[model samples]
Structure formats: structure tokens, C-alpha cells
Target: MAEITAAAVKELRERSGAGMMDCKKALAENGGDTEAAMDWLRTKGLAAAAKKSSRTAAEGLVGVAVAGTKGVAVEVNSQTDFVAKNEIFQSFVRDVTALAMDVNDIDALKGATMPQGGSVEDVLTANIATIGENQVLRRMKRIEVAQGAVIPYVHNAAAPGMGKIGVLVALESDAGVDVLEPLGKQLAQHVAAAFPLALDETGLDQDILERERAIATEKAAESGKPADIIAKMVEGSVKKFAKENALLSQPIVHDGKTPVADVVAKAAKDAGASIKLVDYVRFQLGEGIEKEESDFAAEVAAAAGISKG
Candidate 1:
């Protein structure tokens, strides 16, 4: 048996696009022959992942998990919505979300160890091989509050805590968890429904605001008004834009009339606690990812090695 160096495995993986472990095993089995290892990977169908790797995986669950004052949201995307319904996929998302509670970002979460005895990336690779689709751990966010609660909510959940949309709302206060949990949940749900861009008008993205301002200016110019009037129109439009996109200024989803800031104030007063909505995170599955459109029949023909008519 020939010695299989790390470089050999790396080369094989690069050539075959197979998982690290698989590449290692292939190299070992082939006595460190790179071409043979590639053949082995192809024979085992593991090479299929490489072909599918470029496919857009925009459908999967957005999972949320909360641990005491900390909460995390994760989005795991797959090539098709059907994979989101799979029990194995759901379990993976649930476990990954739980694992995310301890990690600060997507890179750390990917490097974190899964409960099932592998690194998150390793397990994800195994899932892609077994599940027969390209899957990606797209993004994650963590929110924590020192005194209040970090609440989680899932919208259109395929399973508890796993869904197409996941939200985390962090409230800061000296209030009891019992009092804060329900309020946090309501706020989380509102986040999922309203899709606020920021916690307040001040937090809104400057680029986004500028884009809105430009659109408002264009509209105002079309009004055939005086320069001062157009300036006022643009300012008013920008203000309305801020209010609509800011969580604190937006109307609460439940009442449709009360501003979120007022609702939080009222909730705090009713509980006799000073609750402050601090931060929030909302992950909507496939929100920004662009899915590839392909010809199904041509894809089948190509996969079958048949020439097009």
C-alpha cells in the first residue's frame, strides 16, 4: 500500500469535488493514485455533487433556536422545496440552528461540531451526497440580550421552529422572562410579517435611504411644482419611506394601526417593566438568492448522454 499524503487527498478532492472523507478513502483505496481516486468517486456517485454544486439552492427551511437570553436564526437552502419536507433535512436544520446558538456567524457555525459526531461542513457534505441535491448553509444570525429575552418565531413552519421564515427579537429590560417571552414572541412574529429593514429610522441603511430619496426626487420633479415644493415633497416621501421600513415606526402587524414603538411602550407600561426593543433578525428563505432556470427536457437529455434533436 502506498502512503497517501494530505496533498494527494486535496488534489483528489479538487479533481472530484467529493467530500474530504470520501476523497481520503478513495485515495487510500487506490493506493494514492489521483486518477483512480477520481474514478472511485465517480463510481460511488459522489461526483454528482460537483456537477450540482453550481445549481442555485434557494429552497429550504429557515430555522430558529433560542437559549435563554440568546437566540439564533439559520437558513439552509436546497435545490428544491421537496428537500425541505424531508425528515433528514429538517433534522439537519434543527440541529444546525441549535448549534448556531453558540456561534457568532456563519463561518463559525460551519466550523462548529454537530451533535452527530462531525463538523457542520462535513455533515452538510454528507447530506448533499445522500439527499441527492445541492444544499448550502446560506447564513445565520445571533441575538442576545442581558436582562430581557431573545424570542424566536417561525412562519409557515413545516415543523416546530423550522420554516420558510425565521425571526429573532431581542428585548432589553429588567422584566421577568415570563413577562418578556410573550412580548418578544409577538415582536418576532411582527418581524416575520412586516420585514422591517432596521430597528429604527436611524438604523436604516443609508444606501437604501438614498435610493428611496432618488426615486422620491424623480417623482417630485414630475409634479411640475416649484423647487421648494419639490424639495418638501422629496423630504416628506423620504420620511414616509423611513417610517415604513423602520421597525419602531412601522405599524404593528397585530393591530394594523399602532406603531411598533407605541406598542412596545404600552406593553412595557402594562407589565410595569421598562422593556426596550433592542435588535432583531429575520431570515426569509431564498430572499436574495437567484435561482437558475434551465430547460428540464434538455437537462434530462444531457444527463442521459443523449444528443439534442
Candidate 2:
């Protein structure tokens, strides 16, 4: 049996970020071979990560990255907000967001290889083990423009391009970044604040519209109007709802008067180039995710193997 040197254990600990005892055991189990010990440690980490996967991870950061005419946003969630501030978690989010710029979807981003010689998912699993908390690469979105700018904005940033809210504005224009960037930023900020559901009325979900129409119909019936008048009232209400919720039809955030469509048109006229608000992505951290509500006393009691009478 090869003697497990202290130097070998320390090296493995540094490489794998495992507990010192675990590193010593890994090195001992692998005949003092660092490479094999690394693989062993990663296998243990994978198990640890799986154990943590059941914990709720509704807190973390939304990361954004932009390169010229393309941008991507990624949301990474952790078990607590404190983990979001950790440098390891932040670096992982940043690196994953940078990788997301080239991928079209979340699956692709997960499968994409990282500079550190592993897939993004693999790195994420390792992080979960070292951080000792559940984390998830919740979602990713990408936007691009042929000739214009895809600007990115991070609201309440925890780091450079990661925050609680991430927004991307895809401006399809013939103008350069100098002109399109500022306009895109304004639009992105509006998106972050206004929370538009879609680009236009046509882009709104059919289900949501149906629900709105049903509500309008019910309200109109309460007025005790004639059937024909009620029909007209319901239609008017649906149209008004769409106008208020759709991005292009909604009023701009600046003056609260001009429509967003008119704002883009005015910017185009000023820049002497045609600009189109082609697409956008807004990812608020843990949006729509149901979090697990845990009681601290119960958790402590459970950990202590104590049962309530």
C-alpha cells in the first residue's frame, strides 16, 4: 500500500476543494495518485450534489452578457441570498452567462464545454457540492439583431452583469452601437420596470387573452346592459387590456405619455436610420418558481433527531 503523503492530500484538497479528511481518504483510496483521486472526489461530489437537489433554490442572481449585436441572460438560483453574494457562485454565474451567448437554449448551454475542462452542468454540480447548497441553472434567453445592437441591463447588480433582474433589448437597425446602444438601454430599462408580457398585442398569449375576455364579459354582464352593448363593451375592454400590457402599445416610462412604438420611431428619425424593436428577454430571479417554506425550529429539531410529541 502506498503511503498517503500530507503533500498529496493537500494538493488533492486544493484541486477538488473537498474537505481535508475527504481528500486524505481519496488519495489513500487511489494509491496516492492525484489524478485518480480527483475523479474519486468528483464522484463523491456528484453524490453530494444529488443529495442537495431537493432543497429550494429560489434565491440567486440573473446574469447577462452582450457581445456586439447579441446578448444572453441566465438565471442561477441558490438556496439562500447569501450564496448569491459568494464569489464562487457569482463567478460560476458569470462564466455560464458568457457561455450562454453562443447557445440558443438552456440545454445547449448546459452541454456546452467550459474553459475549466468540464460541461457547464458538470461545473454546476461541483459548485453545489463545494458550496453545500442547492443551486439550479433555472433558465436562459438569447436575443440578437442583424445590424443593430442587443443591449443588456442588470438591475440591482450584485456583480458586473448579474443581478436580481436582467433585461435584453434587441434593436434591429442600420445604425451603429453609438446610436442604438442608448436607445436600447432606455428600452431595456423600461422593460425591467414595466414588465410587459409581450412585444405587441399579437404576441400576447391566447390563454391570457381568453382569461381577460372572460373577466371582461363577467363585468359587462354586471352592468345589466343589452346583449349587443355588452358584447361591444367586452371587446373594448379586451382591446384596452392589450394596449396597456403590450410593450409597443404601452406608454413609455420617461414621459408616461408617448407609446413605446412612437419612442422607437422618434429615435429612428433622430438617428437617420430605421430601427425596429425586434425582440426582448426579461428574467427576474425565481419568477414563477414555487419556493419551499421551511420552519427554522422544525429544521433544527429534525437535524437533532428529535420528534414532536
Best by lDDT: 2
* Candidate 2 off by > 4 Å: 1-57, 298-309
**Local accuracy by lDDT, each model:** 0.84, 0.85
Candidate that scores best on TM-score: 2
For every candidate in turn, the CA RMSD to the true structure comes to: 16.7, 18.5
lDDT of 2 by residue, 226-298 (tens): 9999999989978987888899998989889999999999999998999999999988888767666667888
Off by over 4 Å in 1: 1-57, 297-309
**lDDT per residue, candidate 1, 155-251, as tens digits?**
8889999988889999999888888888888888888878888899999889777766765776668778999999999899789878888999989
Q: Model 1 TM-score?
A: 0.78
- Model 1, residue pairs in steric clash: none
Query: Alpha carbon lDDT of residue 57, candidate 1?
Result: 29
Please estimate how well model 2 matches the true structure, expressed as its whole-model Cα lDDT.
0.85
| Counted clashes in each candidate structure | 0, 0
